[model samples]
Structures are given as structure tokens and as C-alpha cells.
Target: MKKGRNELLAEEEKILAPYAVSSRNSGSRAYEEPEHPYRLPFQRDKDRIIHSHAFKRLEYKTQVFVYSEGDHFRNRLTHTLEVAGISKTISKVLGLNEDLSETIALAHDLGHSPFGHAGQEALAELMKDKGGFEHNKQSLRVVQKLERRYPDFPGLNLCEETLLGIMKHGGGYETTQLLEVRRTLGPSLEALVVDVSDEITYSAHDTEDGLESGLLKLEDVKQLSIWKRIESSLPNSEKKSDLHSHSISRSIGRVLLNLMVSDLVDTTHQTLSKHKIESRESIAKAYQNKIKLVHFSEEFQKEFTELKQYLFQNLYRHPEVSRMSERGKETIYLLFKHFETHPESIPESYRKREGEDGRMRIICDYIAGMTDRYAIEKLKREGILWFPY
Candidate 1:
């Protein structure tokens, strides 16, 4: 017998924890529609995100290294996949809703500007007076109003929970933001898992990328206590040679991921116990305090903070990475400026929204949707990124 959506919902009820967000209890979308025959709301949301054009653009989007840097390095798409994987792992172990967590993780970086953070910073500076260019907000915009796939709806028509996760991605949001999700109450446990997974995936993978690129060395990362702890967890024979950088980096990432996941699960369980939160209503009430229930222990937090800071200074700020960032920023500035002067170059779809949302925002939306290669090519095509001399 082929199980249907109702069967899956029943299974979740039996399997998931009291605190988990069940599909049966999922909030309505902005525009309601009949539910799918086979997929739950969050599961359908995950599939919608996976099929979106913006999600595909992530393949050409920068992660830490530029598209021109190398083929093996992590692109935005790869990073998102890793985040999704980690989020699912954490959520499953914590007895949370894996579908919602995976959806949030996959969609978290869908609106990241081309050239990674450098491009974001450039766009932010350009839009500072106009509005702002935070990727989290941009992500919400992408799903809510930018994407045009359905005839009945303008956007993906994702469930409210998925939207909440995308909006509250990076740890903070103003009360004025995403009022639909009721900001007075904090984000769900699934959203929190995605947030932490984003941090964990990037920190470990970026270190691996830096080491692989020769921008950072084994000795360099080993200075951080977190890295040392990870290194110490490995078997003695695995420490034979530094030439095995790739394997060593993978080991380092795995160890750190395990430590973080283990701690997060333990801490979350303890928090639930302490607060006596044994039901969905209790979890919702607990969220009113705006305290994060998913987090590392104090000792782990201190060590991870030190490790993150070390990566920022050593890996992210390496001369090679900085040089790429500078070039990327220049490209973003020039492109935004050119498009500003020649609004006619804007696509008809974007132009249609200009009257309603303003030209700058439409332009930002268009640029934010571009991949790294597309942005570079567009600039070069316009003769703005090069000179005949």
C-alpha cells in the first residue's frame, strides 16, 4: 500500500517529540492552497526551495574562494548542502522536525549576493541610504515577492514556518521584521538548528578551504584550542604527515562538527528539562522569553568563539582572499552604478516591479539573484570591468 500525506503525518505524531513542529500544526501560507497528496507542508516547502532558480544560482556563487579560484572549493550551493545535512543530523537527534530544518538550511543562503560577503558589503554601502542589503531580509524577499513561478501566486508560497526560519537566520532581527511570524515569540527549534548549522558548516569548511588553498597551514589552525582539541581526537597514525592536508582537514571538520552537534543536543535536552517544556505549547511559551534553547555549553562556546575569530583573521583575511574580495567589490560597485544610470538595461520582469517596490530595490533584487560568473560577465559585457588600453 502506498502511504499518503496523512500516513506520514500520523507517523510524525508517533515519532517526533512533543516540542517538534508537526506538519499537522503547520501554519497557513500567505496564499493558502490545497495540500499536496504525498508531501507534508514542510516537505513540500523543501522541494519548492530545491527547484527554485535562485537555488540553482548558488552553484556559481562564491563561498570563501571565488569561482575562478578552483573547481574543488566549496561554492554557495555546496555550503548550503553541507548546512542542510548538518541541520538534518542535529534536528533528527534532537527529536525535532528534520524537514523544516533542512528546508531552512537549504534556503538560508539563497539570497546571498554574488562574490559572497564582499559583494554583500558593496551592495550594503550602495543601498545604505536607500534601505539596506542584508542577505537574511533579501532571502525573505526572494521567497515572498521576487520569485515568479506560479500563476496564482507571485512567490514560492512557502509555509510560514519556512519563511520564519529564512527571516531569523542570523541570530537577530528587529521586532518590526517578519511580524507574520510573531517576533514576540522566538524562532522554532528547527530554525535555531539551521542557524547554528550555518555557522558550524562554514567555520569548519572555510578552514579546510584555506588550508587546501595554501592560504592557511596546519600549524596556523592548530594554534586555536578548538582545532587542537579536534586534532587530539584523531588516531596517532593519522598524524603521520602534514602533506596529507586534505584528509587532515576533513578529520578536523568532522571532529568539530561532532563536538558541536553533541553539545547542542545535550544542552537543548537539558534546557527542555529545566524549563519543563514537554509540549508544543510550552515550547511556544518558552520562546516568548527570546532565549535560544539550542546552543553550545559555556566552555565550548568560549573555545569556538576563539576558533571563529582565528579563522576570520587568518583565513578570511588572507591576502589572496582579500584580493579577490576587492575585485569583487569593485565589480559590484561598477555594475550597480551602471545599472543605476541605465535603468533601461533592467529586465522587463524587474522593471515591472520597479514602480511598486522602487527601482533601487528591484535592481538590488536582480543583482542579488546573480551568480558570481554572471555578475563578472555582465560587467565585462558592458565594458565597465575592463579597458582597451
Candidate 2:
């Protein structure tokens, strides 16, 4: 027999923790529609996110490396998938809503600019006075206004809980356009799981990419506390001295992921118990009282922070990475300048909204939606960037 939506909701009630946001309690969508006969609300949201045009563009958007850098490096799409995977694992083990966690993870980076943080910084500087550019806010805007999939709504019209999870992932909820999302309460446990999963995925995967690209030396990486701990844990037979770089990088990535996830799950369980967060209402109450119930322990946190700092110094700031970052920023700046002076060059869809949203914002929206290759190709095609003979 096929399990209907009611059956799934029942199963969630039985299986998920009391604090987990079940489909039955999911907040209403901005625009109400009949529920699916077989799919849960969060499951539907995950599907909607996967099908969105902006989600597809993530494939060419940067994570730590540009699309042209290489095929093997992690791009925004791969990074999002990894976050979703990790979030689901953490949420399931903790008896939280895995579907909601995965949905939030999938949508977290939808607003990221084409060239990763470099592109975001460029856009931020360009629009500093024009309300500024933050990827999290932009991501909310993308789901709430920019996407035009439905005839009746401007955006995806995602469930209110899903939207809240997205808005609260990176911490600030005061600026959210959703009136129903309470700023007093912190994000749900599912959302918190997604947030931590994002950190874990990036810190580990970026290191792997850096090592694989030879931007980070094995010797330098081995000096980090987290790496040292991981190395010491490995048996002598598995720790071959002359393993290939790719093999070594993969091994390090797998171990790092396991360490972070295991620590987070165990510590979070202890946190939930300490705070007495037995019900959804108590979760909100705990947040109102400023209790953080989802995080790594103090000891593991210091080690993880050290790993991030090392990556920031050695991998993210490497000369080659910086050169590409600068080039990407320059591309965005030049394109924005050209479009500002010549609004006619922008697409008709964006141009049509100039009166209501203003010209600068419209321009930002258009550029923010572009893929790295699209932006670069457009620049070359316009003769803004000349090719040497």
C-alpha cells in the first residue's frame, strides 16, 4: 500500500523528537495552496528548491574556486549538496526533522554571488549605499521575490517554517520581510543542524581541495591541531608514508568530516538534555532565555576554529587564489559599471521592474543571478575585456 501524506505525518510524529518541527505543525505558506496528497511540506519545499533556476546556476558559481579553475574542485552546487547530506545525517541521528534540515541546507546558498565570497564583496562595495549586499538576505529575497515560477506569486512561496529556517540559518532575523517569523526565538534545531553542517562541510572540503590543488602543503596541514589529532587516531598500517596526494586528501577529508559530525551529535545531545528542551515550546523558551543548545563542546570548538584559521591564512589567502579572486571582483565591478550607465543592456524582465525596485537594485539582481562563465562571457562579448592577438 502507498503511504499517503497522512501516513508520513503520523510516522514523523512517532519517530521525530518532540522538539522537531513536524509537517503537521509547519507554518503556512505566504500563498496558501492545497497540500500534496503524498508529500510532506518540507519534502515539497526540498523539491521546489531543487527545481528552481537559481539552484541550477550554483553549478557554475564558486565555492572556493572558480569554474574555470578545474572540474575537480568544489563549486557552490557541490558544496550545497554536501551541506544537505551532512545536515540530514546530523538531524536524523538527533531525531530532528531531517527533511527540514536538508531543505534549509539546499536553499542556504541560493543567494551567493557567482565568484563566491569575492563576488559577494564586490557586489557589497558596489551597492554599499544602495542597501548593501549580504548573501543571506539576498537568498531570502531570491526565494521571496526574485524567482517567478508561479503565476500568482513572485517567488517560490515556500512554507513559512522553511523560510524561517532559511532566514535564521546565519543568525540575523530582524531584517526579514516575513512578519510571522519571531525575532525573539532562535532558529529551530533542524535549522541549527543545517548551519553547523554547512560549517563542517566547508572547513573539511576546502582543506581537501587546497591540498589536492597543492595550494596547501601536507607538512603545513599536519601542523594543525585537528589534523594532528586525526593523524594520531589512524592505525599504523593505514597511515602509509608515501600515499598519493589525492588518496591522502580524501582520507583526511573523510576523517575530518567524521570527527566534526560525531563531536557535534554527542555534544548537542548533552546540550538538549541540560536545557530540558523536551517540547517545541520549550525549545523556543530556551532560545528566549539565551540558551544555545546546539554546538560542539568548548574543546572541539577550539580545535575546529584553529583549522578554519589555518585554512584562511594558507589556503584562502594563497597568492594564486587571491589573484583569481581579484580578477573575479574586477569582472563584477566592470560589469556593474557598464550596466549602470547603460540600463538598456539588461534583460527585459529586470528592466520592467526599474520603477518599483529602482535601477540599482534591478541591476544588482540581474548580475547576482549570473553564473561565473555567463558573467565572464558577457564581459568578453561586450569587448569590455579584450583578448590578446
Candidate 3:
């Protein structure tokens, strides 16, 4: 087949088309028809993500603390940027669609709550009996029904491929399970890349953040059994594993970058060799690289557990935080109650079929959409929605 300008430039290697996509923005596709010159597949991916209302909320979402006393550390916004950066590098090296990876990575955390996972836990508790709340699902909601930049209804209506990639990221286990269930599973290759990229970036980046915060060091991390094995087998593991807090971020970043490029590129090449015209053969998509290996270390495993325990104790479940969180739940409840009493407050667009349950659901959706600061401010203005004395 003669390669067009938009076609992948591979001679012996069978080039994989960017996965099939239908964005939420245009509600079908943001990409220009193949005949159009201006829009491309990847560009559509970028546009859909950028246009998402959920994507915008990410600016205020938490990577760690929703309202950290300090300016340092990665908030969800910065973290998304970092994920996009690393994902793009992986895509570039492996000849994947950089825009698709970038959009998927950036949008991955779109549904995170104000106080990080703590707030999410609280919300989930409230909604456990209901359909339940996972940031990942919320992200899908945001993109599909929240963002309104375009004249189109709600979500960005991003490409199907981008949507699939987002859905599959984070070992959502949808793939492994689906494959197991039917004995045959096929997920978009972009989804697999984003998932692995997330693991790789967060593992190193979180450790880097811990080191920066004076809570951990390379030695502390090496305490992990997984890190130990990866360190032993991977070249220059000893040199890369440094305890020095200050210069180590740069070093660790380099090591992670090297590890990702090596595996993704090699696996991609291998996949290409076996590619048939019917479907694109995907890379192994396993975390056997140095990053994954190091993650399984025993000492590190204990620390990983400890880190969660520490965050819950010191940050998430603290009395002061809990007080605020409880108030958050109550406030959401009251605000929702008001909407039930006065359906006029909600936009007609959000109003679904009429009923008490439907009205309350809208109220919940509104409250859920709020940023921490915005939620607080909204409550304060509305006669101080705080916990009862």
C-alpha cells in the first residue's frame, strides 16, 4: 500500500494506526476527515482532553494534599503534566501516538477529589450503598457530561481510542479479567501504554517526592524487595540508587526515562514484526522493566504500606481533617436537599426526568463537581454548612 502523508513511515515494520477514536467534543470525531488537511488523529485526542470540563478541574484536584500548607510537591495538575511528559517520551521512542498518550495521561486523574484520596474515601463511604464513586468513573462522567466549552452538550466526546485508553489505564484489570472471562481479550494498545506509564512515573515520582519531603531516601526505598531485584538485574542499578535527597530527583528521573524507553521501544519493535493487516499486535505490556521490578522489593513493600498508613493517620484521618471532611459530606447533603426543594436552581440542561431521586442525584452531581475551595466557599456563603454542634 502506498503511504499517504498521514501514514506511518515504516518500510519493513508494519505501522500501527493510531487506535480508533470518536471524541466527545464533536460527539463523534474531532479529527478532520481523512480528506481534510487541518486535523489529524492525535490532534483530535489533544483537543478533546483540553476541552474537557473535568480536565480543567484537575488544576485544583489533589495529588497529595488538597490544601497543602506548602507550595511545593506535585498537585494533581502538575502530576498530570508530568505523566503527560513521560508518556509522550514513551510514545515518541516507541513510535506510538504522542498526542494520544499525552491526552490520556493528562486526563487520567481528572476525577480526583479535593483532598486527594482522603476526600475520595469519604465520598465513597457516603455513596457506597449508591452506585459508588471512583475517580476514574467520575473522570468519564466529566468528559462525557460536564465540560461545556463547546456548543455540544456535556463531555468533550473524545475519540473512542482516547476514551478506551483512559478506561484501561491503572491495571483497571478490565483487560486481564476480560481476557480471562472470554479466553480472548483485545484492548487498545494506547491503553496499555498509559497504564504502564502511570505505574512507572508514580512509583519513581512518589518516592522522589517522599525523598524531597525528608520522609524517605533511596536506601529507604531499596528496603523494597522489588527494587532490590530490579537493581540487581538492571545495569547501573547501584549507581542509580542514591540516598542523597537533593540531587537524586534528577538521577532517578534519568534512570526511569532510560528504563521506559528501553522496554517500550524494544517491545514495540517486537510487536511490529508479528503485526498482521487485520489488527495491530501490541507490546507485552508487562511491568518487567526496572521500575516494576524495584517496586516489588520487600522493604519497599513495607514502606509502601507504611506510606499509606502514614498518610491516612497524619493527613487523611486526622481529627482536624475528619472534621472538615464530615462537614463536606453534610454540606453536600444540604445543598442537594435545597435542589430537591427548589428544582429551579439547577440548569435545565442538568435536569433529567423529574422525581425526588433524580433531583437529589443532580444535587449530588453538582456537589461532586466542586473543587475543595469552591465547595467550602459555596457552603460558607449559604449560611455556613458545617457539622452540627
Candidate 4:
């Protein structure tokens, strides 16, 4: 006999840690619907996010490089998948809710514009007066109001726990105003796991992408404290001359990911123990008192921070990357201006709802949903630019 939803819920209650958020205790959705016969709430949420149009659009969106940069580079969708994988590993190790963590990881970047941070910056400047645009807020908006998948509801109508995890992961000031969460308490352990997993995935993978692109050299990065630490930990035979070769960049990325994940898991266990956080309520109390329950040790954190700083100085700020960023910003600015001046050019579905959502916001939403290729093609169609970069 196959297990049903009740059986799965019972398993979660028995197997998950005391601090984990079980499906039975998950709060109601914005719009109520009958529960599935075999799928748990968080599991259903994961499926819903996976099938959303916004999620699909991530494939063509930028991560560190534009879509045209190369086929091997990580796009937003790939990065999201990596975050989900790492978060699930950490959550399972910590006995937290892996399903909720994975769902939050998958949805975290849905609101990012076409060209990564550069595109988001352009939109933020354009929407400054209308109400500043941040990707996290846009992500919430995407799930809550923008997506039109169901006849009975406007958006995905995700369970409140999933929604709360998404909102809390961003740690924006606006989270305070939401009545469902208390201002003093931090998010669930599942959310914290996803947040750290995101950091780990991006830092490690961006380094690999930078090395692969030839924008960052192995010699320069190997001098970083984190790299040296990872190097020292390798087996004696594996630490031979070939380890320093550029060909080992992928190997380095793998080792760095393992080191970080191991450090985080062990350190978090110690944190929970130190704070006496054996139950969900105790975890909340610890957070209310400003204790961090999920993080690396102080020594590891310093090394990780140094690694990020080195990447920022050497890779993310490379002339090639800056050039790409400038081009992306220009493209976003042109698209926003053109659409604002000619709202009729927008699809009939969006144009029809302009009065309800406001013209500027409607335009923003339309542009935000575009893939990098789509935005570039649209610009070419409008004769805004003659040549593609």
C-alpha cells in the first residue's frame, strides 16, 4: 500500500527534529483549498513553484554572466537548483524540514530581472518614486498577485509557512509589517538553512565560473585564505603539482563547497546546543534574544568573508563583467522607458489590468518577467539597438 498524506505527516512527526516545522502545523494558505490526498503542504508548494511560469523564465536569466556569454555558465535557474540541493542537505543533517527549505530555495530568486543585479538596479532606479523595487519584494509579489494560474485565486496561494519562509529569508524591513510573524523572532531553522545554502552555492560557483571564463586567474585566487585552507585539507597524493593547475578549478569549487557545508552543519549543531534550543519554541526564544542558531564558526566566517571580498575585487569587478553590466543596465533602461511611454504595446492581459495595478507597476511587472534573450530581442524589434552584444 502506498503512503498517503496522513502517513507522510506522521513520518515527518516521528523523524524530524523537535524544532522542525511539520506539515500538520503549517498555517493556512491565502486562499483555502482542499488538501491533496497524498501530497504534504510543503511538498505541494515545491511542485507549485517548480511549475510556475516565473520559475521557467529563470533558465534564460543571468547569474554572473549573460545568456550569450556561454552555454556552460550558470544561469539563475541553475543557481536556484544548486541552492535547493545544498539547502536540502543541510536541512536533513540538522533534522529540519527539507521540503520547506527546498521550496524556499527554489523560489528565492524568482523575482530577479533579466540581467541579474544590474537589471535589478536599473529597475530600482526607475521605480524609486513609485515604490522602490527589490527582488525579494518582487518575488513575494510574483507569488501573491502577479501570477495568474488559477481561476479561484490570483497567485499560487502557497501555504503560509512557505510564504513566511520566503519573506523571512529576504530579511527585508517590510517583513516587520506583516501581521503573521512577530517582529522579535527570526525565521524558522529551515529558512536559515536555505539562506546560508544560497550564500555557499553562489560564492563557490561564481568562483568556478570566473575561473572558467578566464576573468580570474588561478594564481591570484590560490593566495586567498579560504583557498589555502581547502588546499591544506586535501590528501597528500591529491595535493600534488596538478592541484594548482587551472584545470582543477572545478575540483577546487567542489572542495570549497564540501568544507563550507561541513563547517556550517557542525557549527550549527553546537549553536543549538549552546542555546538549549531543543524544541521549536526554544528556537524561537533563542532567536528573540538575538542568538544566531545557524552559521559557520567565527574562524570559518572570516575566511569565507575574505574569499567573497577577493571575488568581488578580482572577478565581479573585472572590466569584462563591468562592461556586460553596463550593457544590461542600458537595455533595461530602454525597455522600461519605451514601455512606460507606450503602455498599449504591452500584452492585452497586462494592459487590461493597468488601472487595477497602476500603469508603472504593470509595466515593471511585464519587464521583470522577461528573460534576458526576450528583452534583447524585444529591444531589437523596436529598433532600439541595431547590433546584439
Model 1 scores worst on lDDT over the 10 consecutive residues at 169-178
TM-score of each: 0.95, 0.96, 0.67, 0.95
Per-residue alpha-carbon lDDT of model 1 for 28-79, expressed as tens digits? 8889799889889998898888999999999999998988888999999999
TM-score, candidate number 1: 0.95
Cα RMSD of predicted structure 2: 1.9
lDDT, model 4, position 30:
81
Give candidate 1 misplaced runs (Cα > 4 Å): 169-180, 387-389
Candidate 4 deviant stretches above 4 angstroms: 169-185, 235-238, 241-246
lDDT of each: 0.84, 0.88, 0.56, 0.86
lDDT of 4 at 49: 94
lDDT of 3: 0.56
| lDDT for each residue of candidate 2 in 1-389, tens digit (9 for 90 to 100) | 89988788888889899889989888898898999999999999999999999999999998988888899999999999999999999999999999999999999999999889999999999998987888988888899999988899889989988988888544333454563455655678998888899999999999889988989888888777787778976656548855445877877888899999999999999999988888877888987888888899899999999999999999889998998898889889999999999888899999999999999999999999999999998898777873321
